[model samples]
Target: MKNEVKHVLGLSGGKDSSALALYMSQEHPDLDIEYFFTDTGEELEEVYEYLSMLEGFLGKPIRNLDPDRDFRFWLTQYNNFLPSAQTRWCTKNLKLKPFEKWIKDEYTSQGYTVYSYVAIRSDEDFREGLSSKNKSLVTKLPFKEVGVDRQGVFEILENSGLGLPKYYDWRSRSGCTFCFFQRKIEWVGLMERHPDAFEKAKSLEKSALEHGSPFSWSEGETLDELSRPERVEQIKRDHEKRLAAVARKRVVNPLRPDEGMVDLDEIYGQQKICLACHK
Candidate 1:
């Protein structure tokens, strides 16, 4: 018997994914895509707000896929070692597992084919995570298929009046509020903007250290050490130098230089960021 097929898109509450969602809604209005967000329980407040704005634009509720267990539970399961880029149990347990569980039960169990839309930009190399183990679940990249780069993403957001997320001014990428992938300067921004969240991250790192974990939230130093006045100043100074270098490289395109400007990845070297979390 032939099975029904479902089109779905997962929004990461980051600019690229949000832009992709808006792009899909406008370009493929005929396709009834079910948009979803895999919540980590430790996401930034701005992420929730932006999700709401996206919901309004889509005229549909973004289904939230929450793990059966939260971060603290998973932390304990990993012997109190905080999840780092090396061992990202947080993404597996919190983000990807919940999503896989939902889709496996809903679509695979019912013998339905699932088309999952991902936002891997044309400028970026396609990584390995988006692949689905279930043969019934197919992954799609509309942005890459249409050759939409970072600038095209920005234009899509601006044209839709959704602009970038408010945290873009400070944080370069979106994921957990205490995402270990954050650079030293972003840690300072966290200390300044969300002191409570910063403190929570510090306490978690302290616990991990006490448990003899090899990693801190950031490498080389503890959050307590990083938050010191002198260290903070140093990080800020280094970041300013990087920004100045980026500014110098910016060529004035008379047509849309002001509008296009620069993006975070340009100023800060693009790390091996998770597409599910940062896209």
Candidate 2:
């Protein structure tokens, strides 16, 4: 495990991965970890802003692994089909591929064993992330090893003073502006928050449908349908109902009353999240 290892961690600009980076920095300060974030070119402007703040705390520039081809190019390659939970070509071509290429081409080819630190929390079961075909590339789960669950992640971020990304107030997951994994409420949140991004998402979905693609960004309905005034209100009501239900079910600790915001995953149920983009 110690033959010229190159320690690296990928930041998803989400609470878990960002917290993990801070956790590793404070806990394993001696490891000399190199942090990186893969740019999908469709990421929210807020994500880039958050990354800038994170860079200050880490005291190192998180390398940007830009894909050789951007999202529009890949979408064209797939016949303009939108990447969905079922067919996540975006992660494959944008996130994982770039990481693999950067590590293998820049480091592994030179005989450096890459130790990729991932942010899989202890509360969750084992979920497969970016797996490497190369024997020398390895993944380390620091959060799971030290029993740091969701609350622990919250604490780590809060204590760091960097805190959660601004989007967490409305959306829990962070990825592309039009991430299909988002709940209906989050799509509504997008429409309200970043209207331009929401419109772009609608345009992409329109293009996909015109190209004979079967899926929309969200599930049954198109973004146009989802954004209608009444439909948006309904989605908001449903979200609030579920949020209250979740709040009632939770056993809140008196010690921390501030960490009681409703997680969207709890409302819609936990979908298979994007480890590379959402963490």
lDDT of 1 by residue, 137-237 (tens): 99988888999988888899999999999899988888999999998888998899999999999999999999999999998999999999999999889
lDDT of 1 at 61: 97
What lDDT does candidate 2 reach at residue 170?
93
Quick one: RMSD of model 1? Answer: 1.2
Against the unseen true structure, what C-alpha lDDT does each candidate score?
A: 0.89, 0.89
Worst 10 residues of 1 by lDDT: 255-264
The 10-residue segment of model 2 with minimum total lDDT is: 258-267
Best by TM-score: 1
- For candidate 2, what is the lDDT? 0.89
Q: Which stretches of candidate 2 lie over 4 Å from their true place?
A: 254-259
TM-score of 1: 0.97
